[model samples]
Target: MTDRYAVFGQPIAHSQSPHIHATFGRQEGLALDYRAIEASPGEFLAALEAFAAEGGVGANITAPHKEAAFALCTTLTSRARRAGAVNTLLRKGDRWHGDTTDGIGLVRDLTDRHGLDLRGRRTLLIGAGGSARSVAPALLDAGILELVVVNRTPERADALIDAMGEPGRAITRYWEDIRELGDFELIINATSAGRDRAAEFKLPLSLVNSMTTAVDLNYGEAAIAFTAWARSAGCRNIVDGLGMLVEQAAESFLQWHAVRPQTEAVYTELRTQLAPLAGED
Candidate 1:
């Protein structure tokens, strides 16, 4: 059997990881089996173990599983250790090694692909979930002037800041305090804001300026709500997560296959396929 790989998370049927990896494999002319497996928190470890036992050589973790996957790893890369999360997992014999590519993926997409300067940009991150945790330190390291994190649960936002060990640079605000917060250079929605009719998606437009760049760390249907909100607010640049997704998937592929695949073609194809879905916005 070809080496098997997969992405594991709840509500994962909508994930594009399988397709992204298949594209990467095709570009590299390698035969690989990559699939999306939905697993709840309770069943994640067992599901991972089963996959590893059944020829799974590598996997990507998403959402609620990043932290859990971090805990389950036999070893971790420094990036994974600092982020307190893991989104990429590699099985070596019986040991699973973990790393996080989210921050790098996000930064590259925003900079290399989107042509934005991260230095001195005041950024507002709108969620404190696993994806947020995975990307926060990266944003800070990318030379943002400041990072303000807000979540519906203040303590969680505070915890995320505390975890970053950048008390001087990263701060937390209550969701209600967003109005008082001044405009930001960058606004990132790292939550599942569009998947449900979450009140959190309804944000104050005062937070943006003519040059503000709005980014929803979600793509497709899950991105519609926040992207719509960003558009109505008149942000200068609005981006969904597809580019970040491709960038991160490429990083994960490099780890698993020791080779990098071209991303522009894959990203373009996926973007075209998702064009019809844009009508949802």
Candidate 2:
């Protein structure tokens, strides 16, 4: 029987997971069925149970559902535990495993693919949400000199830092504390403000320069907000999370099948598909 997998999210119709996975399956010569599943908030649990009942081997959880997926897991990887959220899920004999691969994905894409050295670099992560939480530890582990998290809700930032517990390096700051924070080599937008189509926020122009690289954790229209801000602020390098999206999906594919698919091809294809939305010529 062909193995089955899917990506579950609230508004999953826009998901490129099925396309990415199909490319991976073709590359690896594996027989599988992958799809995008839109599950309402209350339908998440039932969706998982039903998927598992049908022999679904694994699944990827996105947006409004990562935390809920974490809650449903019987076992979680260390990264997932640290993140307090889960993006990838594996079904064992009687239990499910949950893990977050976003950090590794981002790190790999930035360091390996983009040749940006994170070590000894001051990094700014903007958001206290699950995306920031999941990627922060990995950034610290990558040898970033310092990491500061800024959020609209100062308490959420504080909570993230507190949960991180002096893991050697990382600081949390309130919204008002942003101007006091120094400029950084890399700025990461991890908030949903972009996804919600917010026109503006207290994005710090002073904290970025031509040398700084800015990245948004949200893709498509959502990605435009931060990237546009970065460009308007004269930051030369701006990247949306589309590459990270492909990388993270590749990570889940590895976890399920033990084969790391070549991601550049799929990444290129997705980029081509997304170029119009991004206004890429």
Candidate 3:
């Protein structure tokens, strides 16, 4: 029997997990089947249980479901516990194990794929949601000089900072004060605001210069506004989250199969597949 896996999210139609995992499975010559399952809010746990009952060996959780999955897991990797979010789920015997590969995914995409060194760079992270929580510590651990978080709700940002152990290297800034903070060598968007087409939440364009690399933790239509804004601001390197998606999926695959698949080919293929959609944006 083939091993079963899936990815779960609320608006899950756009997930590339199944494709990425399928590529990994093929590369590793594993008999696996992966699918995308849309689990609306309040139904994630039920959906997860149903999948497990039907023999799902593992599943990836995204967006609104990460926290719920974390809550439901009987065991968690240290990264997931630190992040307070879970993006990968594995079944051991009858128990579910949770882990988050998002941070490592983003780090690998930026440093390995893009050849960007994050060490000692002054970074600005936008948003204080689960994505931010998952990636902030990883960025700090990558040796960033400072991490400034700006969010609509200052308290949430503070809470995230607190959760990350309130490292002296990290601080929260009010969104309105972003201009005063000046430029950041790297800026990352961890919010879903772009997905909803809300243009009112603008970043300080002056924050981006020819030297800055701007990254949006979203891909396709959801990343257009932020990437376009970065481009308009004279940022030479603006990246969407597709590479991170593929890299993270590879991590999840390793967790389940104990095999690490080469990601360059998969990343290139996915980029080619998304080219038309990117052009449309």
Candidate 4:
């Protein structure tokens, strides 16, 4: 029988997961099937249980369901534990193992695809939500000189720094004080502020310079505002989350199939497909 896998999310019609995974399976010569399952809010657990009952061995959770998926896990990898969220799930016998590969995905995209050196770089992460939490430890492990987290909610940012267990290396600042926080070599927007066109958030132009790399953990329409701001602010390297999306999916695929897929081809193809929709020329 072919191995079964899927990605779960609400409003999932636009997901490229099925295509990405199918391409990966073909590259590795593995007989498998992957699809996107739309689960309504408050229906994720039920949807997941039903998938597992049908022999689904693994699945990817996105957006509003990642924390819920973490709650349903029988076991968690260290990364998931640190992130307080789970994006990838692997079933072993009757139990599900949860892990978050988002961080590794972002790191890989930056270092391997973009050729950006992260070692000992001062990095600023905007937001303390699941996206930021998922990538914090990975950034630290990558030898960042300092990791500064700023969020609208100061307490939540403090909590995330506490959980990362590197107080000396990581610190939290209020979003309003971002200008005072000084510039960074890398700045990542981990918040969902860009998801809505009317969502108002302040980004300090002083935080970015010609050499700074600005990344938003969102893609397509959700990333347009930040990307535009970064460019106008003279940031030479502005990247959306498309690469991270593919890289993370690749990591999850590796976890399920024990094989790593080359990401350049899939990423290029997906970018081209999304270009028209995203207003890219």
Q: Pick the candidate with the highest TM-score.
A: 1
lDDT of 1: 0.89
**Candidates' C-alpha lDDT:** 0.89, 0.84, 0.85, 0.86
Q: Write the per-residue lDDT of candidate 2 for residues 181-242, one digit (tens) a residue.
A: 87888899988887667666556678985568888888888787777778777665777888
Please list the residue runs of candidate 3 whose C-alpha ends up more than 4 Å from where it truly belongs after superposition: 197-201, 276-281
Please rank every candidate by lDDT, starting with the best. Answer: 1, 4, 3, 2
Candidate 4 Cα misplacement greater than 4 A, ranges: 198-201, 276-281
Over all chains combined, what TM-score does candidate 1 have?
A: 0.95
Clashes (candidate 1)? 0
Can you list the residue pairs that collide in candidate 4?
Answer: none
The clash count of every prediction, one per candidate, is 0, 0, 0, 0
TM-score of each: 0.95, 0.93, 0.94, 0.92
Q: Judged by lDDT relative to the true structure, which candidate is superior, 2 or 3?
A: 3
- Residue 102 alpha-carbon offset, candidate 2, angstroms: 0.5
Q: Which lDDT tens digits does candidate 4 get at residues 26-49?
A: 899986779899998688888988
Alpha-carbon shift of residue 167 in model 3 (angstroms)? 3.0
